[model samples]
Target: MSKPALAVLLTRHPRKPPNILQTLLEVQASLGFVPADALPEIARSLDVTEADVAGVLSYYPDLRTARTGRHLIRVCLGESCMANHGAKVLDRLRAHLKIEVGETTRDGRVTLERTYCVGTCPVGPSLVVDGDVIGRVRPDQIPALLEEYQ
Candidate 1:
């Protein structure tokens, strides 16, 4: 997360600290993932029980509670996407990037993840970077797309 986002999170719920989920989400979105040291501060700033925050963080995979790369790659695993060859595309991407699903590149350039859906079914087998949606992605195209980031 960015430094300014921390300020935003703090200000967003000044008198009233956010709930555990919101606090986690805020920190995660801002920092890409929650830092271990941040738990205490987040708990304090949000006025929530630390255990509650930890429990929620432990439960949700969507809520990344650790460091990740700067760029995020979300591949669709929904039925439509799968039918449209999403898995092959994902495999190709992983091979090209030399990183497995749910892992980040060594240089911190990209993080790969799987999503049940992105709701762009009309153009199934979608890939999202940051938040930009790309539909009809071909397996062979993965490397070229990633090259742009490098």
Candidate 2:
């Protein structure tokens, strides 16, 4: 699916200095995730091996190999957030969604993820739902919040 876009990206940057990381980021940004099928083509374009491309993809937490749900739910696990019952919030979300962290729901509505420090320390236990920063989140609020997305 991403092969054509990758090819165009390669052609567009043919004269520029090789920046594998940036190129990969562009690919992910364009296609949501780094499609495995596009890796070989990307590697060939960059004059590198498939393993090298795969390594870059695996090394970055932000880079996803599989397609995520329509919405991404990131619960902060930083010091302030954890101290403020962030773990409980995560647990509640997982239980309510019936999916573990890093997994998407069967309906493909939401993907749960854990991140560190969203910089909303004053309102600890923050959650970012599809780029909306939600702070002071309570376990009981999860269902209601998720309902909005649904």
Q: Pick the candidate with the highest lDDT.
A: 2
TM-score of each: 0.85, 0.93
- Any idea how many clashes model 1 has? 2
* lDDT of candidates 1 onward, in order: 0.82, 0.89
Mark the regions of model 1 whose C-alpha exceeds 4 Å error after superposition. Answer: 1-8, 15-18
Which tens-of-lDDT digit does each residue in 1-150 have in candidate 2? 545656887677774556778888888787888888888888889888999899988998998889999999999999999899899999999999999999999999999999999999999789999999999999899899998997
- What is candidate 1's TM-score against the reference? 0.85
The alpha-carbon deviation from the true structure for residue 134 of candidate 1, after best TM-score superposition, in angstroms, is 0.2
Distance (Å) between predicted and true CA of 14, model 2?
Answer: 3.6
Local accuracy of candidate 1 as per-residue lDDT tens digits, 1-150: 555567677668555435677767777766678777667767777777778778898899888766768888999999999999899999998888898999989999999999999999889789999899999898988878988775
Question: Clashes in model 1: which pairs?
Answer: 1-30, 1-31
